[model samples]
Target: MGSEFAEKVILITGGGHGIGAAAARCFAEAGARVALADVDRQAGDRLSEELIAHHRQALFVEADVSEGRDCKLAVERVLDTFGCIDILFNNAGITRRANVVETTEKEWDAVIDTNLKSVFLMCKYVVPVMASNGGGVIINTASGWGLVGGKEAVSYCASKGGVVLLTKAMALDHGKDNIRVNCICPGDTRTRMLVEEARQLDLSTDDLIEEGIYRPLGRVGEPGEVAASVMYLASSLASFVTGTALVVDGGGLAGSA
Candidate 1:
Protein backbone atom coordinates (compact mmCIF):
# COMPACT_ATOMS: atom_id res chain seq x y z
CA MET A 1 0.00 0.00 0.00
CA GLY A 2 2.95 2.26 0.65
CA SER A 3 5.65 3.11 -1.85
CA GLU A 4 8.50 2.73 0.60
CA PHE A 5 9.71 -0.41 -1.14
CA ALA A 6 7.81 -0.14 -4.39
CA GLU A 7 9.22 -2.30 -7.19
CA LYS A 8 11.76 -3.94 -4.89
CA VAL A 9 12.32 -7.65 -4.59
CA ILE A 10 12.71 -9.06 -1.07
CA LEU A 11 13.86 -12.58 -0.22
CA ILE A 12 13.15 -13.97 3.23
CA THR A 13 14.37 -17.32 4.57
CA GLY A 14 12.24 -19.20 7.14
CA GLY A 15 9.46 -16.98 5.98
CA GLY A 16 6.56 -19.32 6.63
CA HIS A 17 6.03 -18.17 10.20
CA GLY A 18 7.14 -16.04 13.15
CA ILE A 19 9.37 -13.03 12.55
CA GLY A 20 10.03 -14.06 8.97
CA ALA A 21 6.34 -14.19 8.13
CA ALA A 22 5.75 -10.92 9.89
CA ALA A 23 8.56 -9.32 7.90
CA ALA A 24 7.09 -10.62 4.65
CA ARG A 25 3.77 -8.99 5.43
CA CYS A 26 5.41 -5.74 6.46
CA PHE A 27 7.52 -5.51 3.33
CA ALA A 28 4.65 -6.44 1.04
CA GLU A 29 2.51 -3.78 2.71
CA ALA A 30 5.28 -1.39 1.73
CA GLY A 31 4.94 -2.55 -1.89
CA ALA A 32 7.80 -5.04 -2.22
CA ARG A 33 7.51 -8.32 -4.06
CA VAL A 34 8.37 -11.01 -1.48
CA ALA A 35 9.83 -14.47 -1.95
CA LEU A 36 9.04 -16.60 1.10
CA ALA A 37 11.41 -19.53 1.59
CA ASP A 38 10.75 -22.16 4.23
CA VAL A 39 10.97 -25.90 4.63
CA ASP A 40 7.29 -25.98 5.62
CA ARG A 41 5.69 -25.95 2.23
CA GLN A 42 2.17 -25.83 3.64
CA ALA A 43 2.77 -22.80 5.81
CA GLY A 44 4.70 -21.00 3.10
CA ASP A 45 2.00 -21.67 0.52
CA ARG A 46 -0.76 -20.49 2.84
CA LEU A 47 1.03 -17.23 3.65
CA SER A 48 1.86 -16.54 0.04
CA GLU A 49 -1.76 -17.07 -0.96
CA GLU A 50 -2.91 -14.71 1.78
CA LEU A 51 -0.53 -12.04 0.55
CA ILE A 52 -1.68 -12.56 -3.00
CA ALA A 53 -5.29 -12.19 -1.89
CA HIS A 54 -4.35 -8.80 -0.55
CA HIS A 55 -3.08 -7.89 -4.04
CA ARG A 56 0.54 -8.24 -3.01
CA GLN A 57 3.14 -10.04 -5.05
CA ALA A 58 4.56 -13.02 -3.21
CA LEU A 59 6.02 -16.45 -3.98
CA PHE A 60 6.64 -19.42 -1.71
CA VAL A 61 9.71 -21.58 -2.21
CA GLU A 62 10.13 -24.63 0.01
CA ALA A 63 13.76 -24.95 0.94
CA ASP A 64 16.05 -26.47 3.52
CA VAL A 65 18.25 -23.42 3.66
CA SER A 66 20.81 -25.18 5.87
CA GLU A 67 22.08 -26.97 2.80
CA GLY A 68 24.19 -25.20 0.19
CA ARG A 69 22.38 -26.60 -2.85
CA ASP A 70 18.96 -25.73 -1.56
CA CYS A 71 20.13 -22.20 -0.84
CA LYS A 72 21.33 -21.79 -4.42
CA LEU A 73 18.10 -23.14 -5.86
CA ALA A 74 15.98 -20.86 -3.68
CA VAL A 75 17.87 -17.78 -4.80
CA GLU A 76 17.70 -18.89 -8.39
CA ARG A 77 13.94 -19.21 -8.17
CA VAL A 78 13.64 -15.72 -6.72
CA LEU A 79 15.86 -14.26 -9.41
CA ASP A 80 13.88 -15.94 -12.13
CA THR A 81 10.61 -14.67 -10.69
CA PHE A 82 11.56 -11.17 -9.59
CA GLY A 83 14.59 -10.44 -11.73
CA CYS A 84 16.89 -9.04 -8.99
CA ILE A 85 17.00 -9.16 -5.22
CA ASP A 86 16.93 -5.81 -3.47
CA ILE A 87 16.84 -7.05 0.11
CA LEU A 88 17.81 -10.26 1.86
CA PHE A 89 16.70 -11.23 5.36
CA ASN A 90 18.63 -14.20 6.69
CA ASN A 91 16.05 -14.82 9.38
CA ALA A 92 15.91 -18.61 9.21
CA GLY A 93 17.04 -20.16 12.50
CA ILE A 94 16.40 -22.94 15.00
CA THR A 95 17.06 -23.12 18.73
CA ARG A 96 18.03 -25.95 21.06
CA ARG A 97 17.69 -25.50 24.79
CA ALA A 98 20.52 -27.62 26.10
CA ASN A 99 23.86 -27.11 27.76
CA VAL A 100 27.01 -28.42 26.10
CA VAL A 101 26.99 -31.70 28.02
CA GLU A 102 23.25 -32.23 27.66
CA THR A 103 23.29 -31.44 23.95
CA THR A 104 23.94 -34.27 21.50
CA GLU A 105 26.15 -33.93 18.44
CA LYS A 106 23.14 -34.25 16.14
CA GLU A 107 21.29 -31.49 17.98
CA TRP A 108 24.36 -29.30 17.88
CA ASP A 109 24.72 -29.74 14.13
CA ALA A 110 21.04 -28.99 13.54
CA VAL A 111 21.24 -25.81 15.59
CA ILE A 112 24.42 -24.61 13.93
CA ASP A 113 23.38 -25.48 10.41
CA THR A 114 19.95 -23.93 10.74
CA ASN A 115 20.89 -20.81 12.68
CA LEU A 116 24.36 -20.07 11.33
CA LYS A 117 25.10 -21.91 8.10
CA SER A 118 21.89 -20.74 6.44
CA VAL A 119 23.02 -17.15 6.73
CA PHE A 120 26.26 -17.91 4.96
CA LEU A 121 24.45 -19.83 2.25
CA MET A 122 21.79 -17.19 1.55
CA CYS A 123 24.31 -14.36 1.52
CA LYS A 124 26.64 -16.46 -0.55
CA TYR A 125 24.09 -16.33 -3.37
CA VAL A 126 22.17 -13.11 -2.73
CA VAL A 127 25.28 -10.91 -2.26
CA PRO A 128 26.58 -11.09 -5.82
CA VAL A 129 23.12 -10.42 -7.24
CA MET A 130 22.78 -7.35 -5.04
CA ALA A 131 26.27 -6.18 -5.92
CA SER A 132 25.54 -6.56 -9.61
CA ASN A 133 22.43 -4.46 -9.19
CA GLY A 134 24.40 -1.74 -7.39
CA GLY A 135 23.53 -2.37 -3.70
CA GLY A 136 21.11 -3.83 -1.19
CA VAL A 137 20.49 -4.40 2.53
CA ILE A 138 20.86 -7.60 4.54
CA ILE A 139 19.44 -8.12 8.02
CA ASN A 140 20.34 -11.26 9.95
CA THR A 141 18.34 -12.19 13.03
CA ALA A 142 20.64 -12.62 16.00
CA SER A 143 19.52 -12.70 19.62
CA GLY A 144 20.19 -11.03 22.98
CA TRP A 145 21.83 -14.30 23.96
CA GLY A 146 24.23 -13.70 21.12
CA LEU A 147 25.59 -10.67 22.92
CA VAL A 148 25.69 -12.32 26.34
CA GLY A 149 24.88 -15.99 26.93
CA GLY A 150 22.00 -18.15 28.05
CA LYS A 151 21.73 -21.23 30.23
CA GLU A 152 20.66 -24.43 28.44
CA ALA A 153 20.99 -22.72 25.07
CA VAL A 154 24.65 -23.17 24.32
CA SER A 155 24.23 -24.06 20.63
CA TYR A 156 21.71 -21.30 19.95
CA CYS A 157 23.93 -18.69 21.55
CA ALA A 158 26.96 -19.80 19.58
CA SER A 159 25.14 -19.60 16.27
CA LYS A 160 23.68 -16.16 16.88
CA GLY A 161 27.00 -14.83 18.11
CA GLY A 162 28.47 -16.05 14.86
CA VAL A 163 25.74 -14.22 12.93
CA VAL A 164 26.64 -10.96 14.68
CA LEU A 165 30.30 -11.24 13.79
CA LEU A 166 29.50 -12.48 10.29
CA THR A 167 27.35 -9.44 9.70
CA LYS A 168 30.24 -7.21 10.65
CA ALA A 169 32.71 -9.12 8.53
CA MET A 170 30.40 -9.06 5.51
CA ALA A 171 29.84 -5.35 5.92
CA LEU A 172 33.55 -4.79 5.85
CA ASP A 173 33.85 -6.91 2.72
CA HIS A 174 30.93 -5.38 0.77
CA GLY A 175 30.73 -1.73 1.81
CA LYS A 176 32.73 -0.81 -1.27
CA ASP A 177 29.97 -2.38 -3.33
CA ASN A 178 27.37 -0.29 -1.48
CA ILE A 179 25.95 -3.37 0.23
CA ARG A 180 24.91 -2.88 3.84
CA VAL A 181 24.91 -5.86 6.18
CA ASN A 182 23.55 -5.81 9.72
CA CYS A 183 22.06 -8.03 12.41
CA ILE A 184 19.29 -7.62 14.97
CA CYS A 185 19.51 -9.08 18.46
CA PRO A 186 15.99 -9.52 19.80
CA GLY A 187 14.69 -10.46 23.23
CA ASP A 188 11.92 -12.93 23.96
CA THR A 189 9.10 -12.61 21.46
CA ARG A 190 5.61 -14.08 21.24
CA THR A 191 6.22 -16.67 18.57
CA ARG A 192 6.03 -20.43 18.15
CA MET A 193 9.76 -20.47 18.73
CA LEU A 194 9.28 -19.03 22.20
CA VAL A 195 6.53 -21.52 22.95
CA GLU A 196 8.83 -24.30 21.77
CA GLU A 197 11.53 -22.97 24.02
CA ALA A 198 9.14 -23.36 26.91
CA ARG A 199 8.21 -26.87 25.85
CA GLN A 200 11.89 -27.78 25.59
CA LEU A 201 12.36 -26.86 29.22
CA ASP A 202 9.20 -28.74 30.29
CA LEU A 203 7.71 -25.46 31.45
CA SER A 204 4.22 -24.16 30.80
CA THR A 205 4.13 -21.63 27.98
CA ASP A 206 2.16 -19.10 29.99
CA ASP A 207 4.55 -19.28 32.92
CA LEU A 208 7.58 -18.97 30.66
CA ILE A 209 5.96 -16.05 28.86
CA GLU A 210 5.44 -14.32 32.18
CA GLU A 211 9.03 -14.92 33.20
CA GLY A 212 10.19 -13.51 29.88
CA ILE A 213 8.65 -10.18 30.82
CA TYR A 214 11.33 -9.52 33.44
CA ARG A 215 12.67 -6.57 31.51
CA PRO A 216 11.70 -2.92 31.71
CA LEU A 217 8.95 -3.38 29.14
CA GLY A 218 7.35 -6.02 31.34
CA ARG A 219 6.02 -7.83 28.28
CA VAL A 220 7.15 -10.03 25.46
CA GLY A 221 7.63 -8.55 21.98
CA GLU A 222 5.36 -9.09 18.99
CA PRO A 223 6.76 -10.33 15.69
CA GLY A 224 5.61 -7.05 14.13
CA GLU A 225 7.94 -5.12 16.42
CA VAL A 226 10.91 -7.11 15.18
CA ALA A 227 9.66 -6.76 11.63
CA ALA A 228 9.63 -3.00 12.02
CA SER A 229 13.33 -3.07 12.80
CA VAL A 230 13.94 -5.02 9.60
CA MET A 231 11.92 -2.48 7.62
CA TYR A 232 13.98 0.38 9.03
CA LEU A 233 17.26 -1.28 8.22
CA ALA A 234 16.08 -2.04 4.70
CA SER A 235 14.85 1.47 4.05
CA SER A 236 16.86 4.53 3.27
CA LEU A 237 16.15 5.74 6.79
CA ALA A 238 19.02 3.53 7.90
CA SER A 239 21.22 4.36 4.92
CA PHE A 240 24.29 4.67 7.09
CA VAL A 241 23.51 1.77 9.41
CA THR A 242 25.60 -1.28 8.64
CA GLY A 243 27.69 -3.82 10.56
CA THR A 244 25.71 -2.92 13.70
CA ALA A 245 23.87 -5.36 15.91
CA LEU A 246 20.73 -3.42 16.69
CA VAL A 247 19.33 -4.73 19.96
CA VAL A 248 15.54 -4.82 20.29
CA ASP A 249 15.45 -6.49 23.67
CA GLY A 250 13.32 -4.11 25.78
CA GLY A 251 16.19 -3.47 28.22
CA GLY A 252 16.69 -7.19 28.83
CA LEU A 253 20.38 -6.79 28.01
CA ALA A 254 20.95 -3.54 29.92
CA GLY A 255 22.46 -5.33 32.90
CA SER A 256 22.69 -8.84 31.50
CA ALA A 257 25.94 -10.72 31.99
Candidate 2:
Protein backbone atom coordinates (compact mmCIF):
# COMPACT_ATOMS: atom_id res chain seq x y z
CA MET A 1 0.00 0.00 0.00
CA GLY A 2 2.75 2.48 0.85
CA SER A 3 4.75 1.60 -2.23
CA GLU A 4 2.28 3.33 -4.50
CA PHE A 5 4.83 5.91 -5.66
CA ALA A 6 7.64 3.52 -6.51
CA GLU A 7 9.66 4.90 -9.42
CA LYS A 8 7.17 7.73 -10.05
CA VAL A 9 8.70 11.07 -11.00
CA ILE A 10 7.61 13.99 -8.80
CA LEU A 11 8.34 17.71 -9.04
CA ILE A 12 8.17 20.03 -6.04
CA THR A 13 8.47 23.82 -6.25
CA GLY A 14 10.01 25.69 -3.30
CA GLY A 15 11.53 22.39 -2.26
CA GLY A 16 14.63 23.91 -0.66
CA HIS A 17 13.10 24.21 2.81
CA GLY A 18 10.13 23.83 5.12
CA ILE A 19 7.05 21.99 3.90
CA GLY A 20 8.31 21.73 0.33
CA ALA A 21 11.57 20.17 1.43
CA ALA A 22 9.74 17.78 3.72
CA ALA A 23 7.42 16.75 0.89
CA ALA A 24 10.38 16.04 -1.39
CA ARG A 25 11.99 13.87 1.25
CA CYS A 26 8.71 12.02 1.87
CA PHE A 27 8.29 11.16 -1.79
CA ALA A 28 11.91 10.19 -2.26
CA GLU A 29 11.72 7.96 0.81
CA ALA A 30 8.66 6.31 -0.71
CA GLY A 31 10.74 5.42 -3.80
CA ALA A 32 9.79 8.31 -6.07
CA ARG A 33 12.31 10.13 -8.23
CA VAL A 34 12.14 13.79 -7.22
CA ALA A 35 12.91 17.15 -8.78
CA LEU A 36 13.35 19.94 -6.24
CA ALA A 37 12.85 23.44 -7.65
CA ASP A 38 13.48 26.66 -5.77
CA VAL A 39 14.90 30.16 -6.14
CA ASP A 40 17.54 29.18 -3.55
CA ARG A 41 20.05 27.36 -5.69
CA GLN A 42 22.40 26.47 -2.85
CA ALA A 43 19.72 24.89 -0.71
CA GLY A 44 18.18 22.99 -3.60
CA ASP A 45 21.54 21.68 -4.76
CA ARG A 46 22.47 20.66 -1.25
CA LEU A 47 19.18 18.83 -0.73
CA SER A 48 19.51 17.07 -4.08
CA GLU A 49 22.95 15.91 -3.08
CA GLU A 50 21.64 14.56 0.20
CA LEU A 51 18.83 12.66 -1.54
CA ILE A 52 21.24 11.21 -4.12
CA ALA A 53 23.58 10.19 -1.32
CA HIS A 54 20.81 7.99 0.00
CA HIS A 55 20.47 6.33 -3.45
CA ARG A 56 17.46 8.40 -4.51
CA GLN A 57 17.12 9.92 -7.97
CA ALA A 58 16.84 13.64 -7.28
CA LEU A 59 17.56 16.81 -9.24
CA PHE A 60 17.55 20.43 -8.18
CA VAL A 61 16.36 23.13 -10.55
CA GLU A 62 16.82 26.78 -9.65
CA ALA A 63 13.52 28.46 -10.39
CA ASP A 64 11.47 31.51 -9.48
CA VAL A 65 7.96 30.19 -9.95
CA SER A 66 6.56 33.73 -10.34
CA GLU A 67 8.01 33.94 -13.83
CA GLY A 68 6.32 31.97 -16.59
CA ARG A 69 9.59 31.33 -18.41
CA ASP A 70 11.28 29.97 -15.31
CA CYS A 71 8.32 27.72 -14.63
CA LYS A 72 8.37 26.37 -18.18
CA LEU A 73 12.12 25.90 -18.18
CA ALA A 74 12.02 24.14 -14.81
CA VAL A 75 9.48 21.65 -16.08
CA GLU A 76 11.50 21.15 -19.25
CA ARG A 77 14.58 20.48 -17.18
CA VAL A 78 12.68 17.90 -15.16
CA LEU A 79 11.46 16.19 -18.29
CA ASP A 80 14.94 16.24 -19.80
CA THR A 81 16.41 14.71 -16.68
CA PHE A 82 13.66 12.33 -15.58
CA GLY A 83 11.90 11.63 -18.91
CA CYS A 84 8.43 12.15 -17.37
CA ILE A 85 6.64 14.03 -14.60
CA ASP A 86 4.01 12.10 -12.63
CA ILE A 87 3.22 14.50 -9.78
CA LEU A 88 3.61 18.22 -9.11
CA PHE A 89 3.63 19.98 -5.74
CA ASN A 90 3.09 23.71 -6.28
CA ASN A 91 4.37 24.89 -2.92
CA ALA A 92 6.17 28.14 -3.72
CA GLY A 93 4.71 31.20 -1.96
CA ILE A 94 5.27 34.55 -0.23
CA THR A 95 3.27 36.70 2.17
CA ARG A 96 2.77 40.39 3.02
CA ARG A 97 1.12 41.39 6.28
CA ALA A 98 -0.79 44.50 5.38
CA ASN A 99 -4.31 45.67 4.85
CA VAL A 100 -5.50 46.67 1.39
CA VAL A 101 -4.62 50.31 1.98
CA GLU A 102 -1.20 49.59 3.46
CA THR A 103 -0.17 47.03 0.87
CA THR A 104 2.14 48.31 -1.86
CA GLU A 105 1.68 47.41 -5.50
CA LYS A 106 5.00 45.60 -5.46
CA GLU A 107 4.03 43.59 -2.39
CA TRP A 108 0.64 42.69 -3.81
CA ASP A 109 2.06 41.61 -7.14
CA ALA A 110 4.85 39.60 -5.59
CA VAL A 111 2.51 37.74 -3.25
CA ILE A 112 -0.09 37.08 -5.91
CA ASP A 113 2.43 36.01 -8.51
CA THR A 114 4.26 33.64 -6.22
CA ASN A 115 1.33 32.17 -4.32
CA LEU A 116 -1.26 31.97 -7.09
CA LYS A 117 -0.14 32.69 -10.65
CA SER A 118 2.75 30.30 -10.30
CA VAL A 119 0.22 27.50 -10.01
CA PHE A 120 -1.40 28.62 -13.25
CA LEU A 121 1.92 28.85 -15.09
CA MET A 122 3.06 25.48 -13.79
CA CYS A 123 -0.19 23.81 -14.78
CA LYS A 124 -0.10 25.44 -18.20
CA TYR A 125 3.15 23.64 -18.87
CA VAL A 126 2.81 20.47 -16.80
CA VAL A 127 -0.84 19.56 -17.25
CA PRO A 128 -0.46 18.72 -20.92
CA VAL A 129 2.56 16.63 -20.14
CA MET A 130 0.57 14.80 -17.45
CA ALA A 131 -2.32 14.24 -19.82
CA SER A 132 -0.01 13.01 -22.53
CA ASN A 133 1.65 10.64 -20.11
CA GLY A 134 -1.76 9.17 -19.16
CA GLY A 135 -2.37 10.94 -15.81
CA GLY A 136 -0.87 12.73 -12.80
CA VAL A 137 -1.50 14.40 -9.43
CA ILE A 138 -1.15 18.10 -8.53
CA ILE A 139 -1.05 19.38 -4.97
CA ASN A 140 -1.05 23.13 -4.28
CA THR A 141 -0.22 24.93 -1.07
CA ALA A 142 -2.99 27.28 -0.03
CA SER A 143 -3.49 28.72 3.47
CA GLY A 144 -6.02 28.80 6.30
CA TRP A 145 -6.41 32.48 5.48
CA GLY A 146 -7.47 31.43 1.99
CA LEU A 147 -10.62 29.86 3.36
CA VAL A 148 -11.16 32.60 5.95
CA GLY A 149 -9.93 36.18 5.96
CA GLY A 150 -7.22 37.49 8.23
CA LYS A 151 -6.78 40.91 9.87
CA GLU A 152 -3.85 42.37 7.88
CA ALA A 153 -3.00 39.85 5.18
CA VAL A 154 -5.27 40.94 2.35
CA SER A 155 -3.07 39.94 -0.55
CA TYR A 156 -2.21 36.60 0.99
CA CYS A 157 -5.83 35.82 1.71
CA ALA A 158 -6.82 36.75 -1.82
CA SER A 159 -4.08 34.65 -3.37
CA LYS A 160 -4.93 31.58 -1.30
CA GLY A 161 -8.64 31.91 -1.96
CA GLY A 162 -7.79 31.93 -5.62
CA VAL A 163 -5.77 28.76 -5.10
CA VAL A 164 -8.75 26.97 -3.53
CA LEU A 165 -11.07 27.84 -6.40
CA LEU A 166 -8.39 27.19 -8.96
CA THR A 167 -7.96 23.70 -7.57
CA LYS A 168 -11.66 23.02 -7.96
CA ALA A 169 -11.80 24.50 -11.45
CA MET A 170 -8.78 22.58 -12.62
CA ALA A 171 -10.22 19.39 -11.22
CA LEU A 172 -13.44 19.97 -13.14
CA ASP A 173 -11.55 20.72 -16.31
CA HIS A 174 -9.04 17.88 -16.17
CA GLY A 175 -10.88 15.03 -14.45
CA LYS A 176 -11.68 13.51 -17.83
CA ASP A 177 -7.98 13.54 -18.57
CA ASN A 178 -7.35 11.63 -15.32
CA ILE A 179 -5.63 14.56 -13.60
CA ARG A 180 -6.33 15.11 -9.89
CA VAL A 181 -6.09 18.65 -8.52
CA ASN A 182 -6.10 19.39 -4.78
CA CYS A 183 -4.96 22.17 -2.47
CA ILE A 184 -3.63 21.96 1.07
CA CYS A 185 -4.73 24.72 3.44
CA PRO A 186 -2.23 24.64 6.22
CA GLY A 187 -2.43 26.55 9.49
CA ASP A 188 0.56 28.01 11.30
CA THR A 189 3.18 25.45 10.40
CA ARG A 190 6.61 25.72 11.98
CA THR A 191 8.68 27.20 9.15
CA ARG A 192 10.70 30.24 8.20
CA MET A 193 7.55 31.69 6.78
CA LEU A 194 5.83 31.47 10.15
CA VAL A 195 8.77 33.19 11.78
CA GLU A 196 8.73 35.83 9.08
CA GLU A 197 5.10 36.53 9.83
CA ALA A 198 6.05 37.26 13.41
CA ARG A 199 8.78 39.63 12.25
CA GLN A 200 6.35 41.37 9.95
CA LEU A 201 4.02 41.92 12.85
CA ASP A 202 6.86 43.20 15.07
CA LEU A 203 6.24 40.39 17.53
CA SER A 204 8.68 37.96 19.05
CA THR A 205 8.85 34.55 17.42
CA ASP A 206 8.21 32.83 20.73
CA ASP A 207 5.07 34.87 21.27
CA LEU A 208 3.85 34.07 17.78
CA ILE A 209 4.38 30.36 18.28
CA GLU A 210 2.59 30.52 21.62
CA GLU A 211 -0.36 32.18 19.95
CA GLY A 212 -0.41 29.47 17.32
CA ILE A 213 -0.73 26.91 20.07
CA TYR A 214 -4.20 28.24 20.83
CA ARG A 215 -5.52 26.16 17.98
CA PRO A 216 -7.66 23.13 18.65
CA LEU A 217 -4.70 20.78 18.74
CA GLY A 218 -2.87 23.14 21.15
CA ARG A 219 0.10 23.74 18.85
CA VAL A 220 1.19 24.95 15.47
CA GLY A 221 1.73 22.21 12.91
CA GLU A 222 5.09 20.84 11.83
CA PRO A 223 6.18 21.05 8.20
CA GLY A 224 6.54 17.29 8.14
CA GLU A 225 2.89 16.92 9.19
CA VAL A 226 1.80 18.99 6.21
CA ALA A 227 4.14 16.99 4.01
CA ALA A 228 2.38 13.82 5.10
CA SER A 229 -0.91 15.16 3.73
CA VAL A 230 0.80 15.98 0.44
CA MET A 231 2.24 12.47 0.29
CA TYR A 232 -1.23 11.02 0.68
CA LEU A 233 -2.64 13.17 -2.09
CA ALA A 234 0.21 12.37 -4.45
CA SER A 235 -0.08 8.63 -3.87
CA SER A 236 -2.74 6.16 -4.95
CA LEU A 237 -4.17 6.42 -1.44
CA ALA A 238 -6.03 9.46 -2.72
CA SER A 239 -7.00 8.00 -6.05
CA PHE A 240 -10.62 8.93 -5.35
CA VAL A 241 -9.79 12.44 -4.13
CA THR A 242 -9.93 15.58 -6.29
CA GLY A 243 -10.93 19.25 -6.11
CA THR A 244 -10.58 19.12 -2.32
CA ALA A 245 -8.91 21.47 0.14
CA LEU A 246 -7.28 19.14 2.63
CA VAL A 247 -6.71 21.30 5.72
CA VAL A 248 -3.66 20.20 7.66
CA ASP A 249 -4.03 22.89 10.29
CA GLY A 250 -3.99 20.92 13.56
CA GLY A 251 -7.73 21.57 13.63
CA GLY A 252 -7.15 25.29 13.55
CA LEU A 253 -10.07 25.88 11.19
CA ALA A 254 -12.50 23.51 12.79
CA GLY A 255 -13.93 26.27 14.97
CA SER A 256 -15.90 29.31 13.80
CA ALA A 257 -14.52 32.65 12.70
- Against the reference, the lDDT scores of all candidates come to 0.94, 0.94
Candidates in order, TM-scores: namely: 0.98, 0.98
> Candidate 1: lDDT over CA atoms?
0.94
Error of 1 at 136 (Å): 0.6
lDDT by residue (tens digit), candidate 2, 1-257: 75888899999999999999999899999999999989999999999999999999999999999999999999999999999999999999988999999999999999999999999999999999999999999999999898999989999999999999999999999999999999999999888987898889998986667887578888988899999999988877899999999988888889855
Per-model root-mean-square deviation over C-alphas = 1.3, 1.2
The window of 10 residues in a row where model 2 has the poorest summed lDDT is: 205-214
Off by over 4 Å in 2: none
